[model samples]
Target: MWATGLGSGVRALTTTRFGGHSRPPFDSLNLGIHVGDDPAAVQSNRLSLAGVLPANPVWLNQVHGVDVLQADRVQSDQEPVTADAAVTTRTRQVLAILTADCMPVVLADTRNRILGVAHAGWRGLARGVLAHTVQEMAMRTDGQSRIHAWIGPGIGPDAFQIGPEVRETFLEIDGRLEKFFRRDSSQQGKWLADLPGIARWQLLQLGACDVQWCGLCTMGDPDNRFFSYRRDGQTGRIATLAWIET
Candidate 1:
C-alpha cells in the first residue's frame, strides 16, 4: 500500500499486486472481477481490501471516457457505476479506480471534505477526464475549494511507447503537450509519452495547489509489484482508493 500525503481529513492509497487469492496471471491479489479472474477469488480480494477501507469501495465500470459519478448518491446494493471518475463529500464513502498501466488519480479538498478518484488512460486524458473530475468537485464546493491531487502508479515515460497518431491526438488538445512526448530511438516513428507528467500538467492547469505522484511504473515493474496491461497483454488490475475519514 502507498498512501498519499494529502494532510488530514482524508484517507487515500494505491494497492499493489500482492496479498490476495487469485492465481497465475491474475496472481495472488487481483481485484478486478471483469478481468476473467475467478469470481470467488476476486470477492475474497475485495473483502480483504475492504477491511482497510472506511467502507466498501464504490467501483466504476471505467470505459476510458470522461464521465464522473457522485459516489455519495451510490447505495451499497447498487451495481457498479459506468464512469471513469467518482467524487464525494460524504465521510467514509470510498471511491475507487482500478488500473493496469492506466493512471489512477485521487483528489482531495480537505477543508471542504470533498474527495475524488479518476481512472485516466491516455484516451480518457485526451478526452478531459481529469478536467471533468476537478470541475465536478469544484462545482460541489461552489468553486472555492483548494484541491490537492495525488497521481498513482502507471506506465512511465521511458516504458510507454506511442505512435504518431497518439502524439497528434494530445497535441490537438494542447500544443504545449508536445513536451510530454519524445522520439523513441529504438522504435522508429514511435514516441515515449510521459503519462504522469501530462496528468500533472493538467492538474496544475486546473488550479490544484498541490500535486504529488507515486513515481512507480507498472510497465517497468520487474518485481511484479504492480499490474501492467502494456507489459502483460492479460493481467490483473491494482486499485487506487480514496475517502473522507470521519
Candidate 2:
C-alpha cells in the first residue's frame, strides 16, 4: 500500500493485515494492547510493522477523549498516551492511532512541517477530539497554520445508530453538526450518525483548509482488510501512522 499525502511532504499510511505476525481474531497485524490479543503476538505484530513506519509509533492509550500529546515524549510500554490526539514536528518521530470502528483522522500542514493524528469515536468526536487536534497542531507552529486532514476508514452511518444524549453532545458543540444525523424513526430518541462528515466539519471550523476522507466502512467491509469492533467485539485494531522522513 502506498502512503497518500495531501500533496505535502509528510509520509503517511494506514496499515493492512497483509503485514505483521498476528493470528486469527487479530489475524495478522493487530496493533492494540488493551484488546486482549496475546501481548507477545501484539508485540511481534508491532515489530513486523516497524520496518515500514518512519520510526517507532507513539501509541495512545485512547480513552476516547480530547487530550492531545506530543509524540516524541511518549514512552514505550507505558500507559498509552491516554489522549485521543497526538502531534509531531521533529523528523522520524512517528504519530499513530489504533482503531477498529472509530475514525482515525490523520492530518498534515500545507508545508508538511507538522502532523497530527486523532481517534474520533462517537463519544470522542462529540467530545471535540478533532478540533482539539487542530488546536494542538496550531500551538506547535506559528499558531496560524492552515492544516489539511484525511479521515481514515471506520464504521459507517447506517451501522452507527446512537441515542439522543450522543446527539446532544455534538449539538452542543456546534448545532450545525445536527445535520450529520438522521432521526431513526423506529428507535425513539435515536439517530443514525455520520461520523466522517462530522469529523471533516470539526476540522474545517478549527482552521483546516482542505479535508478528505477514505469513505470505507470497517463494519461493512470484511475482506480481511479491516477489523471492526462493532461487528466483532473481540477483533483486532489497525494503525494509521505518519512521520516526517529525514
Error at 137, model 2, angstroms? 1.3
| Winner by TM-score | 1
Best of the candidates, lDDT: 1
On a 0 to 100 scale, what is the lDDT of residue 229 in model 1?
93
| Local accuracy by lDDT, each model | 0.89, 0.81
Per-residue lDDT tens digits of candidate 1, residues 1-246?
Answer: 656667688888888889889998999789998999999999999999867887888988989999999888888457998999999988888889999999999998876778889999899999999999988898877657788899999999989999999999999899999999999999788999999999999999999989998888998977879999998888899999888886
Model 2's C-alpha root-mean-square deviation from the true structure amounts to 2.1
The RMSD of every model to the true structure, in order and in angstroms, is: 1.0, 2.1
TM-score per candidate, in order? 0.97, 0.91
Tens-digit lDDT track of model 2 for 1-246: 345645447777887766767778788788887887899999898888767776678788889899999776765446665788898878778788899989888888765477888999988987778878877777777556867788888888877888878888888878888789999887887899999988888788777888888878888875758888888788888989877775
Estimate the lDDT of model 1. 0.89
